[model samples]
Target: MANKKVHTSALLEKAGIPPPESISSSVVNEIQQFRKVQPTSKELVDGILNGNVTALSRAITLIESTNATHVEKANEVINACLPYANKSVRIGITGVPGVGKSTFIEAFGKYLTGLGKKVAVLAVDPSSTISHGSILGDKTRMEELVKDKNAYIRPSASGETLGGVARKTRETITLCEAAGFDTIIIETVGVGQSETAVHSMVDFFLLLKISGAGDELQGIKRGIMEMADAIVINKADGDNIKKANLAKTEFNRALHLFPAKKSGWIPTVSTCSAITKEGIEEVWKTILKFLEVTKENNYFFEKRKVQNLFWMMETINEQLKLNFYNDPEIQKLLDSTKKAVTTDEISPFAAAQLLLKKHFKK
Candidate 1:
């Protein structure tokens, strides 16, 4: 039975972690045991000190957990890993389906490994089924890179609710850093508006595109363009080469339509083909340049610090809401408030205030 205790479970149980009470200890023990033999958080911390891939993946899983009890242990792991994390640049990549995101990642991941840097890929696939799992197949798409001992690939699980990113991803990134990865790449699925969640979390946001004859930008979401640190027109080889060049020129023009970000970082447009491995180095170089410029101007570190603050705020807010609403008495009060609103006895805003006051007092 001791073998069944996952670090997450053991840590949570040890910490008296808060989660849905319905979640059985048996389930926690099962997940914990499975992690024990694999490259787990504990192992990864060891590996990261030595730079191991298996350990990195396990650590990512811990960070991605939605279990409330896991939160504390997750934080502990992140704190322990903090000093080792963040040395690697964090980049967020997104695109619609068929934009060659997985392919490009394989190429990009391979390229970074070739340069003697340790690479960790955390992909948020929102469309995965409840039972089957991540369909993007990071390991298969990047078969070559998967074999490299320096690389770690984690596809998002099927049922995660927080915009495809498992709740603990932000924490996971820290663990990856602690484990000594030099470059952390966050890949988001093709969920249109939801991509912003990833954008707000990463240092650099890259939007991948396909070859469009000047018309694609019109179809692109303004919100995504606004958040992108760079726009990459992929599939630049073969027949699409000409179209890709035109698309790049068009995006360059489109980017000028917007003003600079509050941080004063101007997003750039580039092109690459994962099949040929062309322009991959330039993509990596541009990211470094973006970091260099932002860090020099204090935007890099400040932005991440702000993100951490935001993460804390959101986590606290959600936890408070869960704790409040999950109570039977509070739920009854909320139902009564709604009834009052329908009868015009109390405005919604006032009812909310009253409910909060009552909930806290009780």
Candidate 2:
């Protein structure tokens, strides 16, 4: 009876059965030795400086964490890593969904790794609107690069907004640079204004394209063209090679219409076959040439300085918005204020002022 199943209605059998123990002493003892303790910020900093990938990943996770407890620790790690950052070349890549971005990135990353460069790729994966979950399939797609000892790929979700992901990525770049990665490739989700956000954070912006039918120039955004340091026409292999060259010529003609860049660097058009790995070396050579030019004129250094200032102001704006919405007084009155504004009982500006006053009073 003790080993057999007993129904609750059978009181005699049920009461006769002994209760389970409160804690499994043997299981607890076995688990205790393997428990992971959170490393300190100093430990993370030292590990990152010593080229430890595990510590670098943990530091990035702390930066992306929404918990309040992680904020201070994250800040400490960043501050410690700041001196070691900015030694790498930060490149941003974006393109339409079918343009073979992953293929090109993997090929490019492998080429860089072959050149003895430690590369870190931060690929932004699209999140489902309904479930808010990301595919994070970059590692799977870039099988060769994923296995390379000189390369590290981290795929992140484009969460509710691009600003959050951009900020996290920017910080991640610093951590990667500190961890001995000399080349940082940031891959955008290739939707909406993600390209603009990524462009602002990177030193070089690459717009990947593929030759298509007779509409090579259709639906291309003028702003994106202006931002490109180079437009790489990918999939230039087999029968597509001719069309790729034609597309390149058309793009170069279109690029000539844009005003000269402040950096005085002419944007180049190149064709590459990610599958065949043809013309991949030209892209790296072009980047090196750009670095030589930009460094000669000091534009590279000045641009980075300006970017740091812009991010400082951006961070201030983000903090102000977060604090205003998270305030206790504002939280209490937010619903009423929003309702009043929606129903025309109060002006939006006036309701905002009231909330600000209430929040400030506290």
Candidate 3:
């Protein structure tokens, strides 16, 4: 009975009701500090399960950090939040330069939030670097949506190596879901391999294209088109409407030539004008419909379980590689191995095995 009462009380608190003053001061202080700095694994799990937004954001930052010390903590947080993750729809949006990704995202996000949905935008900006401040200029592009209280926008921080994508994006999605965000939007840097990274983490991949005279299809890469579950031709208003219609037909035809995705979801090509806010809702409806079909077919949970395993394997590989390169003794051997290969004293494969044997004690 006591346990049941406690659970009920916590549920009430999570619903935004203030808990009794008898709640432990230590937990309160921990929550406060978690708001200021990154939380420990336990704190993050507790805070997220309790629907604390600050804790979720801090936990995401912890996972994003390349610092070796945070790896174990990040793993713990992910493991704890695993059950709560994958409940939200994960959508990845990518486009080439000047495609109005930010504008479209804002319009789409605001539309969702207006429908009483909690939306989180995990935006990855590849153009920025540590040496120079993140242009962060795109956030400005989302002029109206930035002011919405229900939307959470996180820009890719400086120095992240995976094409401005925070390595912890998968974990971040978990954190957001645990915080009760119903929809999670991952905005990739929209060039080259970044889209691939985004595609791996999302349930649906959306490729944005600009309609140009005789050159609409010319802008997109074939590989990207193959990966997309939906291709949205943006900037579809005003003078481009005719071109946009033509582009949509072109994309619809192009989609037919490729085999269906492994997910068995047919790619849909549509048009939207971020400027005029046309067709934005239709694009969202398509996303929700896809979710419905996948969920009904049991593909949704299966895919998420596979993605979780992929997350663990990728993290382990990254940590092992980091440890190998960061060890001073290993570095010395690696230098010698490189020299041996350069001088033809050892084959590349033999030199690699030799270094592994020396460092791994195998």
Candidate 4:
């Protein structure tokens, strides 16, 4: 019987199966080692300041973490990086679905990198509402730019964020700037309130549109047109060239009706072909000119200051809400309070007041 047991053990070892006890011990050891070796905030900040991409990615992960334990470290890393950030020209790009945003970004990013500029592309992909799953497929679409040593692309899931931007996008931009990216492009999930969110973070907001659609302005919100710094009619190749030109004319006319932007710059309309790479340089030059004009007039710096203030208030609001919702007392009362409201046993306002009173008691 002992020989038979020994033979069975040998066969199990030969089959590459670990003993149950050993398997459990190995997993515990790995978890312990992982926790032990996690980088400190100082180490992450140092790595990012030295232009380490790995450190940048890790820091971003920390920022995106939902774990309460990571919040302190994430904030420390962000504060350290803040002194070195805001050096890049942040640009926001948005367009409706089927407008070829990925293709345009590939060509545009490659062009910027070719000019010896370090470019970082932050793409927000829509998340599945039901499962919270996201494709995060921008890297696959921007194949050529992905290979460029000077370019970095990050695709983030827009989980429940109203604007289709990752919750930590602003923090990620700061990390990228600390890592020496000269240009940061935030490509928002197809047009919506997301455009407004992107506009808040970027120095320039570019709106890309397509041609030959039945109505030139169909499906595009008028508010979006007003927010754009420049509108580019894309896919200006082959038979589409004429339609693109006409769209540009129509957009130019439409833009004239909106109030002038605070920066004293008139938004321009142009045409481009992402595949053929035509007019890409023209669009870039327009951005540079806008920057120059804004910088000369000091609006550029003023706008950034305003943005910083906006984010500071935004962060405080978010933290307050988090604390309110995550409080143990509040959590315990929430289900009953909600049920009371549903059953019409309590007025919604009265229920909210009661919850607030309970929350403040301790």
Best by TM-score: 4
Order by lDDT, highest first: 4, 2, 3, 1
Q: Put down candidate 3 lDDT per residue, 225-298, tens digits, no spaces.
A: 88888999999888889988899999898899999766668989899998788999999899989888888888
Could you tell me which 10 consecutive residues in candidate 2 have the lowest summed lDDT? 6-15
* lDDT, each prediction: 0.78, 0.88, 0.80, 0.91
- Per-candidate RMSD vs. true structure? 13.0, 7.4, 14.2, 6.8
What residue runs in model 1 are displaced by over 4 Å at the alpha carbon?
Answer: 1-48, 52-55, 127-136, 158-164, 325-359
Clashing pairs in 4: none
The TM-score obtained by model 3 is: 0.80
**Which residue pairs clash in candidate 1?**
6-32, 44-55, 47-51, 47-52, 48-179, 63-168, 84-177, 85-177, 85-178, 88-182
Better of 3 and 4 by lDDT: 4
* Clash pairs (backbone) in predicted model 3: none
Model 4: lDDT equals 0.91
Error of 4 at 276 (Å): 0.5
Ranking by TM-score: 4, 2, 3, 1
* Candidate 1 lDDT score at position 37: 66
